[model samples]
Target: MSYAYPRSTGASSLPSYTSVPSSKTTSESWHDLPNVAKQWMVEGAAVFQTARSQDRHDIRRFASLIFRRTFTIPSALILLWLFTLWRGERTVFQESIDACAWENWEKWPQGATPHRVAFIADPQLVDPHTYPGRPWPLSTLTVDYTDQYLRRSFSSIQNALIPDSVLFLGDLFDGGREWATSTTTSPEERYQKYTDSFWKKEYGRFMKIFLDPWMDQNELPIDGRGRRLIASLPGNHDLGFGHGIQEPVRDRFQAYFGQSNRVDVIGNHTFVSLDTVSLSAMDQVDPQTGGTSSVVNEAYPDPIWKQTNDFLNKMTYHRGRAEMGELRMMQNRSEGIQFDYRIVEPADSAIYSNDQDEPVDLPTILLTHVPLFRKPATPCGPLRERYPPSSTTEELEEDEPNSLSISGGYQYQNVLTPKISTEVVTKSGPNVVQVYSGDDHDYCELIHREFNGSPREITVKSLSWAMGVRHPGFLMTSLWNPINPETGESLQQGSSPTIQNHLCILPDQLGIFIHYGCILGLSILVLLLRSSFHVFFASEPALSNQSPVLPLSERRGDSYKHQYQTSGTSSSTLAPNGLASRASITAFPRYPVTKASHDAYRNLDQDDLVTTTSKDKGGYRPARPRGFRQKSVLMGREFVHSVRVVALVVLTVYFFLIWRW
Candidate 1:
């Protein structure tokens, strides 16, 4: 039989093997674990006899993550900027004003997946009357130079936009003449020809300038799709105004592109190419009100508004407000009626984009030549009124199309103009997300904060110079779809388009400031993280175990006992040297778990193994390393802290120097 001590204290606190009586109970023998497990249990029991204290707080470990990523992030940015330089894109911060818009292509937030569409409007490519030796009008885009400018615009588009295809809102041609003359053919024919010669330029030339069907093999659009034919909508200039537009122009224009009112269903999204010119043309009013019939008055009474209304009426998504009223307009305007029609109401009918007479469940995009209306700020603010409405006065003498008054009538309606245009889109379907138009040379993005669902109108800037008031440029929209929300791109499906409107104007020289702000913000974040991690490691609980050393086994002599005193405290010790002088040994060894083996012979029952028995109670002590270990730990921590301070100072100086430069 064998006797064992009570399992009240930790393994490290148990008396030596010789102290236990040589006797064992059947229960203890039957339940004894494997030697491996006893060894593990011994280590586990030692933990209770150890002392530890925690002075650090960790709330999710975010501090360590931030510190580790600091170097990684800056290095990546530097590499990307270097790549941009290699591509001749210029370092993002070093771009000239003219190149800002073009350079924006590379600077867009990385990993954003946008349905990059090339949005260019109002080419208005027609003969602007200047022949050889004639001074170029500030408002004019002469026929000869228009082609050269168009080439330049398209070239820029190819390089900058990287669009899948181009969308052209019309007035593609000024349509005021056929051949540019250096006194060609009979010199007398020019002076004698009717001013109606403006209408004589063939659509063939229009196609070459915009659609570019005859583009040389080398001049083909980069995609080799050959100047991706434009999805077009004719402006008033394309077909003129009122009931008497020259049919030959309409016939020639339609021959190249599809219908003036058409829809292209693309990947569950609908692009409606609408001839608002023709729709506005039908804005016929009651003859009694004295308002003359506008564009295609009676003869070509386009039922665009009505057709669209019938479709929306069939959709189940109507929010039902007086908003439906703008979808269709039926008024009584007699002959020369001129009243304060605060809102330009929609025509009595408008075209709808549908597939086989069914309402589209997909998002719809309305493309038109005449914008819903010009933004009010356009002609009111210092920056906006930069150019007053180019052609506020009507021109009817030549009986030919006047690109000015026919296309841009900025102050034409209510405060939020395009009041009716909004209705056409809203009533079209609850899914209507965007409406794009281009009659105005300036750019406007009217986000409908009041609308319940999506409805944002984007008026694209003119591709070429418009009276030279504002710079000539176009819009670049970078929008994301569902799978791309994580990339940080703006998701237009539920939000406004992630857009950047680039132009020839660059008054902002603060790109560097923005970059610096981002860097400083990150550096401060890294410092905070470093501090947290430093504190966390410093405050880690130390696992301290106390066990009786063999030399302290069962008081051999009074002299040895006299040298050391038992203080009942594991931390209390008397030492004249740097080394610990306690009879009990304490060690902090990391633990690794192992499976137990069921063997009992290894159990100690011999008196030779007997060591000192200790009596200790529960308490917590802050463990301090002794001897040279204490000095080394203090020196290491201070060295690391100093390095951190030096690094922070270096970064501060480096950034300050860069900013000052």
Candidate 2:
């Protein structure tokens, strides 16, 4: 008996082996085989090696093919998703503006004529270093982008609505505050620095971008004859410090925008642009000796008390210089200089006059930065007595009532009451005064009784331009003939004022569309990756058609045989008779059973035979081996196939959702 070991072949080839046995009784002798048998064993071993190498190569190739196919579909889908987002954004933006339709005059209040007015406010051009400059931290709300959107939106409104006039109300620039100069710098240097740095730099940019373009288009006479309809009022920010009360900055503003602060008629409507930056009487007062206490009846008692108390504590006597150029006080009697203009007379007298020597008798529309009479009885007139007398030296030492009753001694007693004695003034038997102001940055309409006993209506409309920081909107108004409510017909007096509040809601629908589209695209990508992972890696049942049965059986049997042959020889030994024997042996007998035997065992009445025989003479019987269980390879294959199917379904759903959105 002999056994032949497998010989090594080339690196790419497998080895061969053979085995033969001489005796059937002893298992050790059976393992020793003839040369032919040994040769066959060697050949079988080589075949197994070759088969295993080929199997590994096939597995690698299969994996590579699967990966390539899986990614191809996803890559194409992603490209399509991105393209959809781009197109969606563009379409939404363009279509949103086009969808808005202008309202017709007839559709408005009956007998009402549509008068479109453009309200522009708070250009708020900021210096990069001094103020919180443009390109604010908020997204899509940066100065450049916001300004561009505004310009386009304005153009749309103009083209679609065709406004009659454009009004610019205040705060065009961040104020000029000198860091190097003390609060007491010369008026000339202060004014010059403000004009050069802040006013010119910040506001200059605004003008070049918006105002200049507007002026160039509309400044020329319309239809070859009509007056240009662009008007501007000075804001405190533009007038530097001291709330536009300074003479130099005030004069400069008047020179640039216009010197006329009174009312003027424009196409049957009067427009009044007022300068509300003049100093109050208390602003010109001194708290110490009371020599310059020009505030006859100090309406603002809080500041008067603070200044009076401070002077008494310091034991200092001082006088205020009334005629001093550019040196004016605030209404609170705080020590500060005026910024822009001087009040040649009191604010009340400067505001109105009915004397033949004064300008009057116009259908007036008053435009001012600050609201008139922020508190009750604070209107320009006799209401001044409701407050205390100007700070006096004796009064400063003691706490006393700052308010006063009507007294004959004070000529300026009624200064805060009224400049005109009536509620309304009439020219040719019709009311001629209407007030228009912008400061609250919101729309309001107020009717108040004037000193002249006539009804005066004031319309306060706000135009906010600080883009996106707050409400970015404007007011659109129309003047229509009053209508009869019952019949819906025009009234005898055909014109009634109507206002429409318009706000820029979204950053041109295009921007919003683009933003959402990006979000949707990212979501799709996440879903696709997740599905691909589960399809390839999840453990599940396999499909029945995955692998051939014969190949799987052969491969599994070969692997087991190779493992046993490699490890079993080391545990075996040969005896003196040239036969292999184990040092210790144990065996357990098992009953040979078939399906027929099992049925007979369960049925007690079934005929059966039982016999006893010598252990050595027992006939060889077929035995069902213990510890052997069938594995469900078919089930595993089906599970894997199911996973792939599920992944495909999920991917389809994801793609459909994206398309719908």
Q: Judging by TM-score against the true structure, name the best candidate.
A: 2
Model 1 spans with C-alpha error above 4 angstroms: 1-113, 126-142, 159-161, 176-202, 212-228, 242-248, 266-268, 284-360, 373-419, 448-454, 482-661
Clashes of each: 35, 65
Q: Please, what is the whole-model Cα lDDT of each candidate in the order they appear?
A: 0.44, 0.39
Expressed as tens digits, the lDDT of each residue in 1-661 for candidate 2 is 8665654332222232333333555545434446556456567776787899899999999998787767654445455545554444334434433443435222564334444455565545434322333355643344544455456545554554455666766655444322112223324453333334444454455656566546545533221213344445655455542221444555555555664243343323445454443322233334343544333335534332232223222211111121111011112232343334756445433422222222222233445554444223222221122233345434232222322222212111211223211211222113334545444443433345542323343323232234222324454444332333233233435334333433222233344546556755664555445443432343332212111112211122222211111122224344676443443121223221223333323332212222222234222211211211111222233334434544465456545543433
Lowest-lDDT window of 10 residues in candidate 2?
317-326
Q: What TM-score quantifies how close candidate 1 is to the native fold?
A: 0.41
Each prediction's RMSD over C-alphas, in Å, is: 24.8, 24.5
* Residue 473, candidate 2: alpha-carbon lDDT: 45
User: What would the per-residue lDDT of candidate 1 be over residues 1-661, giving only the tens digit for each residue?
Assistant: 6544334432333334313323567436524655555555555545444422121224234566566545443344444434432322223222332364434553445554434456767676644322435565723435544554555456545554445456677666553222222332211355334243334444555655555422332343332222344644776555653332445545555765656765553322456666555444335442333554433347536533443334344433322211121111112322222345444435422332223333324456667666565333332211222343334565222222211223334112111225445555665556667777776666555554445454666666666543343355565544333222112222345554434433333112133335556655655565445433332344322323343323322233333221232346545444565444554354322211111100111121232122232323332222223334433444345334534554555556544533332
